[model samples]
Target: MRTDPTQPRLRPARRGRFAPSPTGDLHPGSLLAAFGSWLLARHDGAEWWVRVEDLDPPREQPGAIERQLRTLEAFGLVSDGPILRQSSRDTAYREALDRLLGSGAAFECWCSRSDLAATGGLHHACVSGPQAGRAPAVRLRIPCGESVAFDDAIQGRVAQDVGTEVGDVVLRRADGFWAYQLAVVVDDAAQAITDVVRGADLLDSTPRQILLQRALGLPTPSYAHLPLIVDAQGRKLSKSTDAVPIDDANPLPALRFAWRALGQDPAALESCTDLAGTLAAAREAFSPACIPSESVALHNTGVAIAS
Candidate 1:
């Protein structure tokens, strides 16, 4: 199996994307990610796109995508291009899996969650199995000693040993849906995204995506992981934590707050009439270095001023 070298490489053009799964409403944490990605694309003079990761049908809320889009619109984070739906990209994902298999970069494993759990999470037993051709989830073969390292604009240098840390990650799940890591790498490469800006919660996942890019012979994109928004309990804000959804009825205040949370000085731009202008101002003055590395609690003011 040979790796395809014809896949596009990252060039000077500014292309970025914000992909969100339709599992729930856009909470404050979600807004921070959207704003961060939007600002990164704007600052780099790049085109921004959105991809609906509705691949996992069971977990998707019937109207969650529409609600999420409205929330983003309310916050003035409009993306270019018709939104790409991962559910419609089954053939593309299958082709990518086939390519991985042909290149000997991926293999089929029949290990179930319970089976893998018995051996302490890592799929060591599956890797040593003698069975072949079982209807199994496909896993990428992480080459030994191969290191995935990338320079993150916010987090600085990041390096991961794929074989030991990530093990053989799933490409196609036994449940029939494609894994997030595989779909993301494929979509970003297809869209020619050169930069990825999102929340710090995904910091660990970056290495896995980098591994996929290497195996698929695709160009890796630049990354900037912003500080994560957390609740009073120190857990990352999400629907489960009852984090307030973006207040669509009055979005300006929340947008202002999100900018400040990302370390942009929003005080001077208080007079900005609309969300778009506020975001524009933020991009003009956006500095990744300004964002504090630590997570701060949001106050009644919606701002994440240092604690």
Candidate 2:
């Protein structure tokens, strides 16, 4: 199932997506990503989509998907198309993996964490031989000195040496789940997504994903990594105790906080009293240049509803 060399990758319509892993509830930090992505799509008159990254069943919480969708609905951030869940996308991932494997761009590695510990956890070449019952993790075979560079829409120019900085990346884990790097690339191309807007926390993972896109011959989407919302100690809100789920019972307060965090003027949403109006006004005022490159502190953002 190698990528047809005859068909060249073409840029599609502007499509952006907010992909959230259902490991926990949607906090303000998560809302910032959701809101920012939604606003960007609306501002560009593009299609916005929501995909649940539910590939890891063990880390996912029960009933989290339903709650996450409900929270998005409460905030008026509905997807332009039907929601896509990674759990149901196994066949597509397999096909993409097969293409990479057939092309010699990917390989099965028998290395475990301990096997690569001495080499700083980078799988240059598999050190451990295949075990009797253990399955080998599939990883993209990054050639020596291979590098990837892209101009981030918001973060500006970015570059990384794949072989040295990231080593070979896993496409399917030893635990029998499709890795995020592979699943995301496959899904984005399948959905014809042209733009990717998410938190800066994932900025490092971009190069790895871009490599996968090239390997699969899929069109790489424009990426904009938004600043992450951190806690008092400057920890990402999602990793801190302050990552409490924002109250959907009153969505405006949370929306205002996210809007302001995105560097949008509070005055833009100040006059709007409801979610619909606020979103409309915010969309008109949204500007990618206004987004700060620095991480935002949670406490620094005032959560009080605009009077």
Candidate 3:
């Protein structure tokens, strides 16, 4: 007994996610990122999941997550699966840390602020100090002369040597919270993400992520880094930057703006009166390769920048 030879090979479903920190409301730049990710996933007939990156409690605003998700919904960017919150996934992260520690892929760093600045901060375990009763930060050991490279969807071929450019990166902070680099890598693997589409500002972090993936025996996904959205002064928009929140009362304007900013044609979408119809049209007409250029500035648009 054998399977039919003419049967097509079954491919696993592609998974893409939009993980935003709950530090602020949805700005135009973040909206653009979400829009691009949504279009790509929907166009591919893939799963689009949303993850709340609420790792740092101190930095998170009280109600920013709810506002952000509501804003995304008003723009017709609904997620496919139940939302995931990083704050609730501490057990998984701890297990991953234990595995890394057992495998010697991670080490406790005792480097002080002054030592890191003085020693170029590229090597791990360089300043092993008093570990009497303090919890030292955990750092990944980047092998020397290691080159991490990947072909990006938008930015073309990108490569970096983590050992040379960036030394051992912290996985856990002294404050006992998991570092973003470690948490993101672990969660991406756990979620079985197939592609990562996000702002180009995080392009530099890819190499480190790839390194972690390999070390942790996790799968590395394809990446697409969109151009950073800058303001009139060429400043990138973020919680720390000057970016206006998208008003939910009139979401059409901001939605159209984000669509155009992602390099999507707005000729027909502009006529749409409803958010769902607009998103449907954009998704049907989307082509990942057609998103021309990288950066978009919203200096005079009375909106935020593009990313």
TM-score of each: 0.88, 0.94, 0.93
Off by over 4 Å in 3: 1-3, 239-241, 300-307
lDDT of 1 by residue, 5-98 (tens): 9987566778888889998888777887887888778777788888899989898988999999998886777888778999888898999999
lDDT winner? 2
Candidate 2's residue-wise lDDT over 192-214, tens digit each? 99999999999999998998898
Pairs with backbone N, CA or C atoms under 3 Å apart (clashes), candidate 1: 1-102
For model 2, the superposed segments whose C-alpha errors exceed 4 Å read 1-12, 305-307
| Residue 6 lDDT in candidate 2 | 94
Off by over 4 Å in 1: 1-11, 125-134, 300-307
lDDT of 2 at 58: 89
User: Where is model 3 poorest over a 10-residue stretch in terms of lDDT?
Assistant: 298-307
Q: After superposition, how far is residue 197 of candidate 1 from its true place, in Å?
A: 0.9
User: Which structure is stronger by lDDT: 2 or 3?
Assistant: 2
Candidates 1 and 2: which is better by lDDT?
A: 2
Worst 10 residues of 1 by lDDT: 298-307
lDDT of 3 at 222: 89
- CA lDDT of every candidate: 0.79, 0.90, 0.83
Tell me how far the alpha carbon of residue 145 in candidate 2 is from the true structure, in angstroms, after superposition: 1.3
